[model samples]
Target: MKHLFSLLTILFLLSCASKAQNSSKEKKTYKVEKTNAEWKELLSPMAYYVLREAGTERPFTSDLNKNYKKGIYVCAACKTPLYKSEHKYDSGSGWPSFDRAVKGNVELDVDYKIGYARTELKCNTCGGHLGHSFDDGPKTTGKRHCINGVALEFIPKEK
Candidate 1:
């Protein structure tokens, strides 16, 4: 009985830890940092939900999901260029999908929000949660960088 009790306690703690990690903002130091109030003012409610709270927008709700143009995608909070137009693709995931990120401009962390580990992507400059990455993707890099449109600001390429 003693061993069983200890085991149950450990499992409970582990589950709680994962939940906290999923809901909380990353703790790592970012180059661009701002208080919650500052971030709230600079970002829209939806943007703040997706970027700071690590929330997801409803599928098929983003205008950028079907956008096909020449441009670069930058972090909404900080204008850090993340994905180039050439790398963007239609993964049918309802959110903006990119084959890869601009090298070192985005960061990846493990997320266990749904009881499974998913690769959570973040803006390297400001540490804003962008989205998750999956292994299923085009042959180029075999990386599906599933991103939230609200977390990105598209900048049209200068013609």
Candidate 2:
């Protein structure tokens, strides 16, 4: 009976330690860091508007929405893989939509711009604004990750 109690205590300690470690590894708030000159040189005006300034792109404007190849979609500002092509789907909203983000990647914040509540998506590492999330999406996840085109860069899978 005493040995069983000791084993239980050991397991409890190990579980607590793991929980603390995992919490520490979670992503935190981030801020953008780039000079205007560098941003201008690296991104077009529209891309800059949406990515750096948190402006929204008009619906159905991104070519990536129609993309069907297998690849990873990355943040255009920080090159962090945000979504997989397998998660992409046609939402007919004029923007690229993903049902989910890459595992252990990306970050989300509560946004209330224009008197409406939304979940703002951003790069976990750089904190660049990606876009908003909505509940109206296809079956499976019921999440519409309405992302701007200029905010992402696609890396097609090698054949």
Candidate 3:
């Protein structure tokens, strides 16, 4: 009976491991799908780097950081509206900071690229890398979405 119990435990462990592996192998699908070549051609060099390759732009380099006009910020790659001007605020992070994104427009994922777990935010529509979200933010939302400016385009609110 003891030997049988041990064998059953081992089999259960193996089964659990197998399920974990399968889940990891599953890839996330996005609404706006595009070929790599198409993305490269459609976005500017820096935009492509940030959105497609998950690269970061230099701090304080994006004009959108200081933009205060009423507008909607859209994904530069797919034209999906991500954030509103009303949510934009200066977090002194030298990047465009927003307290929240448009509902259901941004998705969060875990990333360990920087040697620690970070809340990585992506455009839900295109799966484009937008930026990392942090907990240090104003009391309103307590979410600091530190986005790459190149990953977004501002559409000024029309009168």
Candidate 4:
């Protein structure tokens, strides 16, 4: 009976130790935890409105849309790399347009808001609302991914 008790106690202690070790070794993922007021302070009014509240910036207003430089575009929310410079093109819609997306990066949804049918693009990692895509583009794929400059941060490639 004493030997049986000792074996059970040893097993219980081992189980607890294993659990503690596992928890300690587990990787911790970091998420941005900012209050609305804090976020407003951290970002510009336009960026905060569009990225956090899903507001749309006026068309033909973003300077980045007119940009034709080579660089990688990243998500403004989490800084995750999203689109490539090669994907960019001039669609004359006032927003930065792309023919395709970075592989396995963004989430696309069919948006029917305000009696208009469009494809809404969003950041897959941070869920930041980007903008709508259209079928008018200068590409063989015929996809014009109209993106909001507020939702993206451009990093010009090294010359």
Residue-level error in angstroms, candidate 3, position 27: 0.8
Per-residue alpha-carbon lDDT of candidate 3 for residues 1-159, written as tens digits (9 for 90 to 100): 999999999999999999998888567899999999999989999999999888899999999999999999999999999999999999999899999999999999888888999999999999999999999999999999999999999999999
Query: Which digits, one per residue and each the tens of the lDDT, describe model 1 over residues 43-133?
Result: 9999999999999999899889999899999999999999998999999999999999999999999899999999999999999999999
Backbone clash count, each prediction separately: 0, 1, 0, 0
Ten-residue segment with the worst summed lDDT in candidate 4? 25-34
The TM-scores, one per candidate, come to 0.83, 0.76, 0.89, 0.72
In model 3, pairs of residues that clash are none
- Clashing pairs in model 1, backbone N/Cα/C closer than 3 A: none
The whole-model lDDT of each prediction reads 0.95, 0.87, 0.94, 0.82
Which residue runs does candidate 2 get wrong by more than 4 Å? Answer: 1-32
Q: Which ten residues in a row have the lowest lDDT in candidate 3?
A: 19-28
- Listed per candidate, the RMSD to the true structure in angstroms reads 6.6, 9.6, 2.4, 9.5
Best-to-worst TM-score order: 3, 1, 2, 4
TM-score of 4: 0.72
lDDT per residue, candidate 4, 55-96, as tens digits?
A: 899988888898888899998878888889888988877788
Off by over 4 Å in 3: 1-17
